[model samples]
Target: MRIQVSRQLLDRQLVDVDGRLVGKVDDVEFALDADGVPYLRTLLTGPGALGLRVGGRIGRMLVLTAERFVTDRPMVPLRIPYGLVDRVDSAVWLRIRAEQLPTSPVEEWLRRHLIGRIPGAGRAGG
Candidate 1:
């Protein structure tokens, strides 16, 4: 589909069919074919990939912050293969629900150690 890369694509949140948030578009992956032609391979997200794309001090700080959350020194980006994408409009839609995919370690940690500890944290705010 013909889409305005910046407006219709970038920075938009990706959600699964069931309405679970996957992530935002941090970067797009590309693949080269036999003719040396490149095509969109996947959508990359998470603080690590986004930090590098953002660049400079701010980006480095973001990466470092994310790294501190996990035992690993470097945080890894989440990859959503292009084939799994169902459509693109105001936001990207995925064919499957987010629970099917691996959960972000940072998110799990926060929910368990931080958010879960607070009263009414389980409830969503309007």
Candidate 2:
């Protein structure tokens, strides 16, 4: 499909087959094909990718704030290969379930550190 990356993709929500909110399309990666033609290679999501895409003081702040909750190491954005995308309409739909994708580091950190401490967090719909 011929997609208008800026108008149709950037900032769009990413939903998996099970209809879970995975993340947003923070940035897109491109790679050259055999003929030296560029094609969408992967979809990147997370503060690290968003920060670079929105480079500036505001972007740096975003990265810094998210980093504060984790380790000293730099954050890594979640990468979704373009082939995994089932379709793109109102939202970018993935062919697989959210559970199949590698868990987001920031998300794991927050759940373990912050959300995990909250009462009733362990239960479903709590």
Estimate, for each residue in 21-63, the C-alpha lDDT of model 2 and write its tens digit.
Answer: 9999999999999999999999999999999999999999999
Q: TM-score for each prediction?
A: 0.88, 0.91
Query: Once superposed on the true structure, which residue ranges of model 1 sit more than 4 Å away at CA?
Result: 123-126
Count clashing residue pairs per candidate.
0, 0
In candidate 2, position 45 carries an lDDT of: 98
Clashes of 2: 0
* lDDT (C-alpha, whole model) for all candidates: 0.87, 0.92
For candidate 2, the TM-score is 0.91
Distance from true location, Cα of 41 in model 1, Å: 0.4
Clashing pairs in 2: none
Cα lDDT of model 1 by residue, 1-126, tens digit: 776667877798999999888999988878997999987887888998889989999999988888877886678888888889899977899999999887887898898899899999979898
| lDDT for residue 74 in candidate 1, whole number 0-100 | 72
